[model samples]
Target: MKILFFDTKTYDKESFNKQLEHYPEIEIEYLKADLAPRTAPLAKGYDAVCGFVSSDVGSETMDALREAGIKLILMRCAGYNNVDLEKAEEYGIKVMRVPGYSPEAVAEHAMALALTANRRIHKAYVKVRENDFSLSGLMGFNFYEKTAGIVGTGKIGAAMAKICRGFGMKVIAYDVHRNPELDFAEYVSLDELLSRSDLISLHCPLMDSTYHLINRDTIAKMKDGVILVNTSRGGLVKTADLIEGIRARKFFGVGLDVYEEETNNVFEDRSDEILEHSTTARLLSFPNVMITSHQGFFTQEALAAISGTTLDNAVAFQKGIQNGNEVSA
Candidate 1:
């Protein structure tokens, strides 16, 4: 079967090409343009379209794809907040995603962010490069015996909790459905977790209830100078509120792998151009804030799992076999 891939980069091509050897029957065409209404017609003859987190798979795009005879929407990443699930259902387009592609990869990245931000390693590296080795601004606290609040308790969050435990930090988690397997973390109320945690890491999905979960009022609930890390969906935190919080010196440091308006700039290199997004520009002005392009799941193990599962999901759809990866509105 033929499939069209959207917003593909060099790494995506490399990983998918390597995994394509295992599935000789499938042929994939890569496109740099993201999947939006204007580009949906490009999949006219393909049986499926593969998209990344940045792709716009709204109702209009889904309608265009349906008219173009596209039957499947295969998401290479875990998050599907960008896709209009109800519209895909109406258009008879089956949606599937790689839900748990190397949870350890993302969990480890979250820890790395927290560690880097807490110890101010980025600043130290810059200072050392210039032969200014004074440790005056590099003062940092020990992770041992600190309270770590985890906002989600899925596979990724559970893995993060384990890492925090290894550092001798007390881990607490807040989730609608608690994972009994996360014995290292104690489940608590959202308010309790926010008010008590010294380090707060977000690992939740973006949904209506979770949109801007860390807003102005929620930030007010957090401990003063709390270290915050987000390796999850960008919409989970309101960028404006975060900016205000930073101005108030409410956070010790912030590490972000995703942002609410990252789709326009994340994968592309626009260093020569001026940044149009005011919030992102303001965020970059802060020395304590560290932002990375959405790359939490960019490891080799994660890419292999994503490509393998995405191909398996496509094969299942072609054979009319239902599996756990299938998503509906």
Candidate 2:
């Protein structure tokens, strides 16, 4: 069984090779390309193609893959929004993904973002480096006794709620599909969570129903000076509405690991050039906003788990095993 890994980075190669050593019988070859329609011809004779979050697998690319005789589409990450699943199913291409790698890695990053943003840690660190460590504008509130609203109760969201509880915070959660395991965190309606929470953290997935879930009306229901954190998919929060909320002082701080328009923007080398997008440029102008690229699941533990599971899924699919993470129509 031969596999063609697309969008191969140095870390991906190193980590995948190390993990795949456990299965020495399988032959794996990697191609380092964006995997669009133009590049799909590269996977000529491979049985499966592995892709990352940044790769574009639209209808054209899917058609190209079908023509290339590709049977499996293995996604290293959990989100399938970048791939057209409907078209892949239509073309008889089986899709699989690593559903949960290391929930703690992402949950920790979300908490780190919230803490850093709320306390102005980046600005304070810069000031200290410049020998101007005055206490002005560095005042931050205590996390204890604060109400934290968490959206989604998946593995990552559950971990986040536990962390918030450890900080002596009262946690309230809202999820379309509630997890019975998250009994410690009180389940509340979206409006109630927004109305009462001092800090709001989003950990939901990206689907048609969840797109731009946090818009102007939702922001209006939030507390006067709420801290917002998003380690989930970018499209969950409306960027324009968030900007307006920030300007109006409805949002005290924002810690984002993703953005609404992040295609070709995040995880790329653009430091030498001027940013052309006005929304991104404006988001960076605010002192209270800390925007990190989508790296919430970039820890070593998560990478190893993701690589191992992805290869395992590929091996299972090739061997006709009953895999749980297989994508269906």
Candidate 3:
């Protein structure tokens, strides 16, 4: 089977290429452009189209892909918020995703962000680079005996909770469906978690109820000087509200691997160009705020799992065997 991959990065090509050796029957063509209405026609002769989190798989793009005889939409990442599931269903295009690819990779990255920001490790690295390490303004509280609020209790969230527990922290979580396996954490209301947690980490998906979950009012509900970390979907937190919260000094530190408006900015080089988004620009000006380019799932283990699962999904679909990874509206 022939597959067309969009938004091809160097790392993506490397990982996929390494895995492609195992699937000799599958041939793939890579493109740097993102999948959208304008580029959907490029998959005219391909059996499937592989996309990432940044790809625009909306109705128009799905329509174009369907017209081009594309039967499968294989997402290489866990999040499918960018995909129009209803359109895929209407077009008879099967959508498959790597649902859980190394939850530990993302969970560890979330902890890295929280620890890095909380201890001001980045600042200390800069100071030491200039041979000036006085340790002033680098005071960080111990994670032990602190309250950690996990917003979701899925595999990733559960992993994060375990990590926090390892730090001797009290773990509290807020999720619609509580996981009984996560007995280490006590399930509580969102408001209760917000008011009680010294460190709040978001691990939820982006949905109608979760969009802008951390907004103005929600930020107000959080404890003052709380450390906030987000390694989940970008839209889960409002960038404008987060900036406002930083201005008000409501957060002791903010570590973000994703942001609401990071579509074109993330995974792209814009160092030579001026930032168009004022909120993102203002966020960079703050000392306590650290932003990464949505790289929580960039680890080797996660990439390998994603490539393997994505290929397996494609093979399963081609064989008309429903492996239960197919998604619908």
lDDT of 1 by residue, 1-329 (tens): 99999998998899999989989989999998999999999999999999988899998998899999999999998989889999998878999999999999998999898888888888899999999989867777898999999999899998999999999999999999989988768899999999999999999999999999999999999999899999998899999999999999999999999888888887899889887755778887988888888888989999989999999999999999998998888
Give the Cα error of residue 145 in candidate 2, in Å.
1.1
- Over the stretch 1-329, how does candidate 3's per-residue lDDT look in tens digits? 99999999998899999999999989999999999999999999999999989999998998899999999999998888899999898888999999899999999999999998899998899899999979997888899999999999899999999999999999999999998988889999999999999999999989999999999999999999999999998888888888889999999999999987788887999889987755677887988888889888888899899999999998999899998788788
List the pairs of residues colliding in candidate 1: none
How much is the lDDT of residue 192 in candidate 2? 99
lDDT for model 3, on a 0 to 1 scale? 0.92
**lDDT (Cα) of model 1:** 0.92
Clashes by residue pair, model 2 = none
Minimal lDDT window, size 10, model 2: 260-269
Q: Indicate the worst ten consecutive residues by lDDT in candidate 1.
A: 275-284
Candidate 1 residue-pair clash tally: 0
lDDT by residue (35-100, candidate 2, tens digit) is 789998888888888888888988999999999999998899888888888999899999999899
